[model samples]
Target chain A: MSLYRPPRTQSSEITPREVYLSRRSFMAGTAAGLAFAASGTALAAPLAATPSAYKVADKLTPKQDVTTYNNFYEFGVNKSDPAANSGDFKPTPWAIEVGGLVAKPQVIDLEKIMTEIPMEERVYRMRCVETWSMVIPWIGFPLSALLDRVEPLGSAKYVAFETVVRPAEMPGQSGFFQPLNWPYVEGLRLDEARHPLTILATGLYGETLPNQNGAPIRLVVPWKYGFKGVKSIVKITLTEKEPPTTWKNSGPSEYGFYANVNPAVDHPRWSQATERRIGEGDGLFGGRRVDTLPFNGYADEVAGLYAGMDLKKFY
Target chain B: MALPALPARLKPASVWALYALGLMPGLYAFYLGIYGGLGADPVREFEHLLGTWALRFLCAGLVITPIRDLLSVNLIAYRRALGLIAFYYVLAHFTVYLTLDRGLILTSILGDILKRPYIMLGMVGLLILIPLALTSNRWSIRRLGSRWNSLHKLAYPLLLAALLHYVLSLKSITLEPAIYIAVVTVLLGYRLVRPKLMERRRARRVTATR
Candidate 1:
C-alpha cells in the first residue's frame, strides 16, 4: 500500500499554493477539451508551439507511420504490436518520480508538468538501431526545462529512466516468453539530459500522443538511437554511476550504453551505413534507402558533448 | 521398411488442394502489403513475411519423409509441391530484397551480399535450391532415374543454409527464430538417423527368416 503512495519531496514548498492551483486549472482547461483518441485516430487539438532550431529540414514521416509503426515492446515485439495491443493502456493520472542524487526530488504530476512547460515543435530525425529512420514533428519542451526544476546535485553523473511495467495492461510484459527484461530502463549522461535537443515529448502531429506512441509523456533524444528515448516513463533517477539499460544488459556487445547514432559503428548484426525511410515508399514497395548521417545529422549541436571519447568504443 | 501405399483417391485432388493452401500465405501477404494493411515499412514487412514462409515451407518439405517413415503417413505425393512452393517463396523473398529494398541497384545488392554474412548465407541457400526447383518435375526425375534421389538430397544442405540465414538476420536472439531452429534440428535429426534404424530393422528380419 505504501508503494502506491506518491513520494514526498523537499521541492513541495517551492510552488506557492495559489500558483499551483491556478496552473492546475489552466492545464485542465486546455487538456479537457482534447479528444483522447485510440490508435490510428486523428489528434484534433493542436498544441501551441514555436519553431525550434533543432528541427530537421527533412520531410516529416507520415503521421500514420509515426503512430502505427512503433517499437514499444512493452506492448509487444512486432512493429505493429504497439498500435494493435495498446488500446487499453491507461496513461492519465500518471506521476513521474524524479529522485536520487537531487536537491529536491519530487513526483511531478503529468498535468502540472504539461502546463508549466511551454511546448515547442521540433522535427527530429529518429534513427532506430535496426537501421530504419523517421523524421517526426514532436511537440514538447526540452528535457533541460524539467531537469532544471528538479535541480540535480553535482555528484549526479548520469540520468536514468524507467518505463512503466503494467503486465495487466501491457500484454507483452505478461506473455510467457517476454522479448525484453521488464521495466525497460535507459540512461543518458547528465550533460545529454540537459542538452536543448533532448525533450520530454508529450505529443506529435498537433495532437496528444497516441497510446501506442507512448501516450501521456515520453523522452525524445534526437541524436541517440530511438531505443534511448524510453516510452511511458514512470521513474527518473539521477545516479553517480551509469544506469543499466535493458538492451545493454540483454546483449552487451550489440547495444552500448552510449547509443549515439554513429553510422561508422555498425550494429553487430547489420550495417548502420544506410537506413530505409519508413514512410518514403509507395503503399506496396517504394521506400528508398539513404546513407545514415553521423550523430543522425545533429553533429554540430551535440557532437562536442562527446569531446575526446572514442565513439566507436562507447557505441 | 516398406513404404505405405497412399490412399487411391488422395492423389490429384489432394495435390491441388494442398498447392492452393500453400499459396494462401503469399496471397495474404500481398493483400496486406498493397492495401495499407501492412504497417509502416511495408516493404520490410513483406520481405520478412516472404522469407519466413520460405523457411517454413522448407521445414515442412523436409519433415514429410520423417513423418512417413515414423508414422506411416504417406504424404510423399505432396512433398514436391511443398518444395516448389518454398522455392517460389525464396524467389519472392529475393525479388523483394533486390527490387523493393535495394531498388535493383546491382552494386549495392552485390556489395551487401558480399559484405553481410546473413545475406551471403541467404544467397547460398537460394543457390542450392535452384537445381532442386528446376528439376522438380517428372521429366527430370524420369531422365535421371536413380541419380534423381541423390541430386534432391541437396534439400538437407539447403535447409541448413536457410535456417542459419534466418538466425543471422535477426536483430537479437528471440524465441521465434530459436523455435524455427529447434524445429529444423529435429527434422534434420530424424532424417539422419532414419536410414540406420531402417538398416537395423532389415538386418533383424533377415536373421529371423534364416
Candidate 2:
C-alpha cells in the first residue's frame, strides 16, 4: 500500500535533524511493525493508497517523561490535573466494544488489541485548542483499518466516538463548569475518518500508554485540536448525520461542529497560527517556535476535501 | 499617654499563621511544576496559577474592611501583611509571565501588553500593588505619618484594577470575578460611608447631653 503523501508547499524545507530522527524511529519501530505484519489479520482492510511522511523524531522523551506528563481533563482545568488526580482511576481489566454499522462488531480486550495491530511510529505535531503544542511519537495504526472492519452503511456520513464514563474514576464529572460531557464525545466526517492522518493510537513515545494519557486506547486526529480526539474510548457509532460532538454542544460558536483544524481561523481568545512547542528544549534558553500549518500541515491531502467550503463560517 | 493602642488584641502571630496557610497553595503549585504537574503547558499553568493567587489575595485584602466593619473582627494587624502578599503574588505572576511565557523579551511583552486589554488590566493591577507593598511596613507608615493613610488608600484603586483584570481575562463575564467585584464594593463602601454615620450619632448624643 502506498503511504499517504501530502503535497508539501515547500518540499525543500526538511531539516537534517528531521531526516535523522525519521530513519531512527522507523528502524526502532520495526519490531512492532513486524509483529503486525505477522498477525495474519486481513479484517476488512481498505485501500490506503496515499503514502505518508509521518516519521518520529529522535529526541522523543522517555517513558518517564511521557507517562508523568499528561493533559487529562478528568481532574480539572489544569493540564497537570490528570497526573495529580489520576491516582484515583483504575484502568485495569479494560475492554473496548467496537460495535456500530460494521460487518464485524466485536468486543476486544486491550491485550489482544495492542498485540493484534501493527504499531507504526509517527511524529505528529499535536496542537491543543488552548494554543500550546508538542511533537509526539505515537505508535498506532490507521483508524481506517479498524473502521473498515465495522463496514459502515452507505448512509453513514459521520462517525461518533465516546469515552468510558465512570464518575468514580473521573472526578471532573462532578464539576459544574465542565466544557465537555463527563464521558466526552467527538466526531468526524466520514471522509475525515478515512483521512490518512487519523489513527487509533495505543501508545506514545514508544511505550504503552499511561492511564493519564488515555491508557487502553484513544484516537489521534492530528489536524483537529487535541479535544477532538476522544480518549479512553469505549464506543463508536456511525450515523447518517453529523454526530453530536461535545465541544460543539457546549459552545457551538466557539467550537464548530466540524472542528477541522485551520490556522487561518483564530480561536476566540487566541490565535491558532502559531503555538508554543512544549518540551522542545530548556525552559529558559531558546524555546522553540513552530508555525502551525493548516490541517496541522496535512493540507496537501485534506485540503482538497474542503476546497469550496468557507472555513471562516465553519470555524 | 495613648497606651500603645493595646495592639488591637489580635496577635501578629495569628496573622503569620494565616499567611503560612495561604502559601500552601502556591507551594503546591511549585511542587506540581517540579513533578511535571504543569504537564505539556507549564507556562500557561504558571501564568494562570500566579494570576489567580494575585487576584485571590487582592480580593482577600479588600475583604479586610468589610469583615472588620460588619463583623467587627478588627483584622487590622493582618491587613498590611495580606496586602503585601497580594503584591508579592502579583509580582511573581508578572515575573513568570514575562520570563517564561514572553521570554522577558521587552519587545514582545510590551506588544502583548499593548495589544491585549486583559494584559493591560493585569499590568495595571500589578503596578498598583507595588506601591502598596513598598509602603506596607511600619517604617513607611511612621515616616509618611498622616500621609501614610492617604497613600495606602490606593488599595481601593488596586482592588478595582485587579477586578478589571479578572473580568477581562475571561472570554465571558464569569460569576466568580463578578462576585469578587461585588464583595470588594461592599467592603470599600463600608469604609467610605460608615465614619459619617458614627460622627452624626456622636453629635446627636452631645446635643442631648447639653
Candidate 3:
C-alpha cells in the first residue's frame, strides 16, 4: 500500500470540506428526523444545475426556510403549520390522471414521470399573493413535456390541476370550517400551461421534495402568484372552458382566474407594491421588502403570452 | 363550584410570580431571535408571539370578573397585574411593528395606520389601553377614585377592537379567531346580566326575612 492514499474521488475532493461536511450532516439529519431542527445553515447544499438562460441571478432562499415556510393549505392555514403537520402525509405511490379533451387520457405513476422526463434545475422567483417572495432552485421537467405526452386536442383551451384531498393526510381539509374547498383547484390557459417556464417540479435543492413543499410532484408557474402553482397534484384536466379555481370560487372579486403577479393590482386587503423576501434578514426586522415585480420578474419571457389582454382586468 | 381565594399574605408573592411568568414568552422569543431559531421570519414570528400573548392576557383579565361572580373565586388582587402585563405586550407588539417591520419609516407607519382598517383598529385598541395602563398604579387609583372604574371600563372596547384587528388581519376567517370572539362575547354577556341577578337575590333574601 502506498504511504499516502489517493483522494477517494475527484468530485468529492473538489467540494469544499465544510460544504461536504454540512451536506453529509443535512442528509444524516434528514434521515434521523432532525431536519427541522437543523436551521438554514446546515441544510444549505451546493446544488448542481446546468446553467440556463431562464435561471434567476438572485441568491437561492435557504433550503430550510423554503421547506418550512410553506402555504400548503391542505396541511394547515399557518405558514409553519404545514411543516409541523405534514409529518405523517404519504406522498409515494402517487399517480396523476391526465384526462378531458386529451387525445390519450392516462393515469401516469409518479415514478414513470420521474424516470421518463429529463429533469433540469431552474431557479425561479416565487412571489406569494400575500406579498412575500423567494428565489427557489426547482428540479423538474417542463409542463409542456407532460402535456405533449398527453397530446392535448384542439378543443383543449385550458388546463386545470387538482390537488389530492385526503382528510386523513391533510388536517386542514378535515377541520369543521374547511379553508377553501377541498382538493384545491387551480388553472392556467393552455398556452401558459405549455410555456417553457411552467414546470412540474419533483425536487428542490438536489433532493426529493419535502411533504410540506408538495412532495412527489407539483406545478411551478413562475409568472403567476405562488398559489397558482398547485401542490400535491393528482389530476390534470384539459378543458374547453375556463376551470373554476378554488380561490376564485371562494372570493370572485378578490381572487381572479388569471392570478398573475401584478404590483399594480393590489389584493383588495393589502398593497402588492412590495414583497418581504424570506431568508434575507434585515437585522431585527424579520425580512426586508423589495418592490414587487411584474410577472414576478419573468415578464420578458411571458409578457408576450398575455398580449392584447388587459392585465389589470384579467388579474 | 366555589374556589378558594389566595391568602392575604401570599398576594404580593403570587403577583410577583405571575409577573415573572408573563415575561417568559417574550424572553423565549428574544432567545429564539438571537439563536436563529424563529423560523424563516424572526421579526414576524416575534411580532405575532407578542400580539398573541397580549390578547391572551387581555382575555385572562376580562375573565376575572366572571370567575368571581360564577365560581366565587376572588382574584381581584391579580387583575391589575394581568392588565399591566397585557399593556406591556401590546406596547412591545406596536414597537416591534414600528421599528422592525416598518424600520421606523414614519411615513409608511402613518400611511399603514391610516389606510389599513386592521392597523387602524389595532391603534385604536392601543389608544384605549394607554389611559388604563397609566391609571394602574395606586396613586392614579386614589386620584381618580370612583372615576377610575369608569375610565377602566374602556377595557371592553379595547378587547373588541383587539379581537376585530386580529380577525381582519388574517386573509380568511378561521376557527381560532372565531373562538376568541365567542369567548369575549360570553364574558361581556355575563358582566351585563350579573348585577341584575344579584339584585334579585338580595330582594328574595329580604322577603324571606319579612
Candidate 4:
C-alpha cells in the first residue's frame, strides 16, 4: 500500500471546532427532520463529522433554503425542480468505481468507504455560475484521501468524474430534449483534484445529503463555481490528457474547463463581478448583491496551484 | 372558425375591462413575489416573472394583427390596449431591474448594458416603446394621421429586440426558450405575407360578387 500521507491542518492553526459547529443538537434534532416530515419527504441519517479548518466568516445559507434550492439537473433544470422531482432517486446500496491509470482500480461500497476515511465539516462559500452564492456546511473528507487510496500512476495527470446515468431514476435524463448530455461529466487537473480545499461531500447541516443536494456523494471545490462540483458521482478515472467537461462542451464560449470563480472574467450573458448572497438579509431584501472575490476568496490557499500559468487563457 | 362580435353598445365597457384584465397576471405575480411564492431568490424570480410577462404581452400584441388577417378574427380594437399593457409591463420590469435587481448600482447596471448583448437588446426595446407609448393616444393619433401608422410600425423592431433579449437571457437554447423563439419568429414572419394574402382575399371577393 502507498504510504504518501497528505498534510493535516494543525489544531492551533485550525478554526476552533466549537466556534464553527454551533447549534449542533438543534440541527441534529428537529429543524431539518421537521421540515422534511412536514413536506412528507424521507430524511437521510445524521452525519457525524469533525469540524475542519476550512470555514468562512459569512453566515450559513439557511438549511431550508440550501436543501430546497438545488441545481441537480439529473432531477431537472429549474432551481426548484430538483427538490420537487428527486423523490424517486435511490442513493442506498451505491458503490463508486475508481479505475483508469490507477495502480489499484477497484469498486468501493459507499458505507465502507465512508467508515474508512475521516470526514470533516467544512463551512465553504459556494459561488454558482449564475452569480449566486451560498455558505454551506458540508461533511466530507479531502479528495486527496480518496486519491491516495486509489494510488494514481505517474502517467495520471487529470482526474475525471462521471455522474451516474439512471434514466429510470433521473427524469431529467429521460426527457426528449435533455438540457445537458447524459452521464453528466466533469474533470479537474490532478493538482486541483488533490488540493486540500477540494472535498468529496456526503452530507450537509449535520445530516446526510438530501437527494436534491446530490444524495450519497458529491464533490465540493470552494474556489470554483458550483457547477464544477459534480453531483451524485459514480465513477472517477485518472487520465494523461485533459478530459472535456460538461459545461465546456455545452457552451464553449461561456463555460471554461477551469470554472474558477473569477469575478474579473465576465460571463457572456451576465457579469461575474458581483454575486447575490442567497438568504442574506431579512424578509423581501433577503438576497443582497455583494462583490465576488477572485478564486472565491480562496486565492490565499490555492492560487499557488496556478502560479506561472495565465488563468485567463487556461480558464 | 368565427369569433362572436361584441355588441356595439357593450364594446366600450368590454374594451376597458380588457385593459384591466390584461394587467391581472403582472399584479398576481407581484403579489406572489411580495408573499414569497417566487422561491428562495425571490428578487430574481420576481424580476424574471415581470420580464417574462412583458414578453408574453408583446407576443399577445403581435398575435393580434395575425389573427385579424389569417383567422378573420377582429381583435383590432384591443390592439391599442395590448400595446399599452405591454409597455406598462415593460416599465414594471425595468423598474424591478434597476431598483431591485441592480439595487440602483449605476456603475454595475451601465457596465451590464454596455457589455451584455441581452441587456442591450432589452434596453433598446424599452427605448423604442417609449415613443410608441407616448403617441398611443387619441390626440397624437388625430394629429399624426397617416404618419402615426408608419411610426407605430416600430412595433416590428421592438418585437425583434425584445425576442432577442428574451432568448439571450437564457444560458443556452434550451427547449422552452427555443420554442418561444420559434413561435415569435412565425408570428413576425406572417406579417410579411399578410399584404399579399389580403390582396388575394379582396380579389376573390370581387370575383365572387361578379
Docking class of 2: incorrect
How does residue A287 of candidate 3 score in lDDT?
62
DockQ for every prediction shown? 0.53, 0.20, 0.40, 0.54
| Highest-lDDT candidate | 4
Best by DockQ: 4
Per-model TM-score versus the true fold: 0.87, 0.72, 0.89, 0.92
What's the C-alpha lDDT at position A115 in model 1? 84
Candidate 3, residues B63-96, lDDT tens digits: the string is 9988887777888889999999999999999999
Q: Rank the candidates by DockQ, best first.
A: 4, 1, 3, 2
Ranking of predictions according to lDDT? 4, 1, 3, 2
Q: Give candidate 1's iRMS in Å, 1 decimal.
A: 1.6
- Candidate 3 chain B weakest lDDT stretch, 10 residues: B1-10
Residues A1-315 of candidate 4: C-alpha lDDT, one tens digit per residue? 111123233445544445434444345477784564545134566788887667775667887789888688888888888888887888998999999999999998989999999889888899999989998989999999999999999999999999989888888888687879878899999999999989999998777888889979999999999999999999999999999899999999889999888998888788899998888664446459998999998888888998997877777
Candidate 2 regions exceeding 4 Å error are A1-53, A56-62, A88-116, A175-179, A283-286, B1-42, B77-81, B104-111, B114-117, B127-210
Residue-by-residue lDDT tens digits, candidate 2, A1-315: 122345332324433335644654575578875554332121112211222368533244433345545556666554555655655666667787776666677777776665666667666767777676766767678888777767877777888898888877777667565645566888988888998789987766545555677766789988788888788888888877787887787777778876767877876645566677777554333455456778876677677878789999976
The model with the greater lDDT, 3 or 4, is: 4
Q: Report RMSD (Å) for each prediction in the order shown.
A: 9.1, 8.8, 6.7, 4.9
Error of 2 at A51 (Å): 14
Clashing pairs in 1: A281-A287
